[model samples]
Target chain A: MTETPVKVLVVDDAATVRLYHTSLLSEAGFAVEEAANGLEAVEAALTTAFDLFVVDVNMPKMNGYTCVETLRSETVGTPAPVLMISTEDRPGDAERAYAAGANLYMVKPVSAERLVRVARMLTAGRGIPA
Target chain B: MGLVRRNTPPPEETAAPPSADTLLSQLDDPDPELRREAALGLDGSAEAVAPLLDRVAGETEAAVRDAMLTTLAAHDTAQVAEGLAVHLASDDAGLRTAVAETLATMPNSVPALLPRLIDDDDHDVRVMTAMVLADLPHPEAMTWLAVMIREDPHPNVVTAAIDALLPSIGPEHHELLRGAVERFPDDPFLRFTVEAAVK
Candidate 1:
């Protein structure tokens, strides 16, 4: 029997970034979906049982930190692994992402190889074939 | 007694509009609703810009902040744009996004400010400025994007400029986009983004 592909949601305000990330992950054999901002990401999380979330910081209406916090909050509690990506490389950016409950934080311009590798590693326990 | 209609106007209708000073004081009120009303009431008051900006820097309530932003945006002055631009460095992502949105609405006031913001030492600030340029309706937006795509040192900032340029891509931009791909020859993402834009 074939195993269902691991589901991933990639959220970003930039259409080009969303396309770039989605294209890379989809080609890497993961099922990928898209959201424009934190609010949309939260709304999608409320219904979908995604195995992973790839979110961006500095989105309108909502932001990555707040989105991760809400995902981990009691309202829409989901323990899915989150990978927060941003252009911000400040001293506290990673700590803030972790404090908001992200499993990992990466700066922008993440290479395709590293993104796919991280996604696979984070979801390895979910039985996704490497 | 026979039914009779009172001829006097209602007290609410006769009340004087709140003074700018009263509204300014209410910006610090305990009730958010009152603060929001105060912000709304201060719209277009030149003297209120400083205080309104002060409140915006510390205003935690989204509703009040939004009202304040709207009021501040109505001024559409360089001073207002500069005031809002300072928040782009905020740790609060939401505030940065809000400030960007507000800045996008003040095209007439932003041209003088755009170059400085795009050239900021912080890459994140530059990226946010690129994001604003993407949505800014001014005709010079494309020109600014081209400069950023060509000159900015950061790949993320250049990619953001490319994103802003994609919708309006033309023959003139093809070479520039290709140059960006060549500039960052090792960056697959920038190459992919430029390919997607030019093709």
Candidate 2:
């Protein structure tokens, strides 16, 4: 039997931003899933098998920070790495993501190359979704 | 501490001939564009990965680093896989796109290494993931794509999956595709693709 590709869930409010990041990460050899809002991202995470997560901080419905926080509260034992993508340049943004249980935080507009590199790093040793 | 020869990059080092390693030596050149050009041009060459890996940490300019990432994309050499992995983590869109193209063509570390990209948060990365997975046709990819077409909000990703389906999709997925096309008439690509597939 053939194995499954790792699944990444991307959460963002903008259609274009979601498309761009998804295309870049997918091109770089990733299997991508998209959520238009933070609530959608959270729902998907709870049900689907995801290797990694790339979320936006300022999405409609549930924001990325809240989504990650919710996931941390509900995942019970294993917590997948959360790579938060945001436009806020403040130094505290990183702190906020960490507080919300995000493993990493990136500022937008992050390049396609940089996003791929980070995905590989976070998912490198982890138990990726099949 | 010692006076290093400025003109030449040393005999033993230049053996690979014409690449980023040699180009990196010129990054310090007075010309800004030359530095940028060299950084971009050295990508993916066997000689460039080592030094580029080091320089990536220190280089601050987005323009120059972007060039370096392009150069890195040219690298399919196994010698640079580790560093290439590092670039894969980068947040730069251009570099990620380059790496995706590069990964699609090259022999990656393992079939196992391909999955991480599929589930990436970036949409381009996901679309590219379909392409790279086509190179190997992992089963998990088909499942992920199938779900995306069903649940994802964007039509582009759905279209990408339809394009990737026949080549990378395994035999067990026929039923899934059939149901999918039946459910979503909006997807013309899948409609045509499924028609072609049955043929």
Candidate 3:
């Protein structure tokens, strides 16, 4: 039997960053979809069943914290793990991410190896294909 | 010295839904959630847009301002165009990026609203405006790119304009492209952008 690749959504307002993340995840055999901001991300999440969400913090229409909250809220109510990545490393940033329902919080320029490893670790035993 | 603790009753707060008037007033509230809720409350009415644009100009909170923008984006009214123009020069990069995305979605509104932003004091606004214009088939896009390449002070804006102009730059505009190259000879990135575009 063939295995379905784990579906992931990569959301960011920056075109360059979105492309970079999408390429990295796509190259690693994960299905990737891109959203320009949290508004679009929420819209996509409502329609599509993604296994994971890689979200950026500061965006135009909706920021990351609100987006994650909505994902956890009854509006979408998807329990899929969310990984919040942003340039913001200020006090309480990680706490805010956790409060908003993100499973992991990472800063920008995260090492490629670390990103893939953490992604695999978090999704392991969640019934996704190896 | 005696330390005294006085018991005080909690102040009574009303739970009534805010009226339209109250909502508009709350658009400037110190709390972003309050401002966002206020904007959402006012979003369905066409009459509320004028006040919404006013709030958009001074609203410092991103979520609140984005709420206002989302409301504004739903309509294609002249008021919306004006609102977009007002935010084109915003110091907030995120807000400006949002405005650019909104403008890109409404390509018909671009020609009339975007030119003014090309000359904006903020170079990021110019770059973003140019990038939005690049995506469309509008004739004004070429003219604006030429103007930006010739006069825009920032190399980034000029480089973006050059990138936008590449798809259609023909023999007639070659000199104009060369002029940009000559104008910013010291900027390797700008020169490289022009050279790549011309090639």
Off by over 4 Å in 3: A127-129, B1-199
- On DockQ, the candidate that comes out on top is 1
Please list the C-alpha lDDT of all candidates, in the order they appear: 0.91, 0.63, 0.75
Cα RMSDs, all models: 3.0, 18.7, 14.8
lDDT of 1 by residue, B131-169 (tens): 889888899999999999999999999998898788999
Give the better candidate number (1 or 2) by DockQ.
1
TM-score to true structure, per model: 0.93, 0.39, 0.48
Which lDDT tens digits does candidate 2 get at residues B140-180? 55666677656544444555565556555566766766766
Error of 2 at B134 (Å): 37
Candidate with better lDDT, 1 vs 2: 1
Error of 3 at A69 (Å): 1.3
- The digit string of per-residue lDDT tens for model 3 on B21-77 reads 998888878889988998888867787788887777677777777788778767766
Task: Write model 1 residue lDDT over A66-120, tens digit each, in one string.
Answer: 8999999998999999999999998899999999999999997798989999999
What DockQ does candidate 3 score?
0.06
User: Which candidate, 1 or 3, would have the higher TM-score against the true structure?
Assistant: 1
Error of 2 at B173 (Å): 41
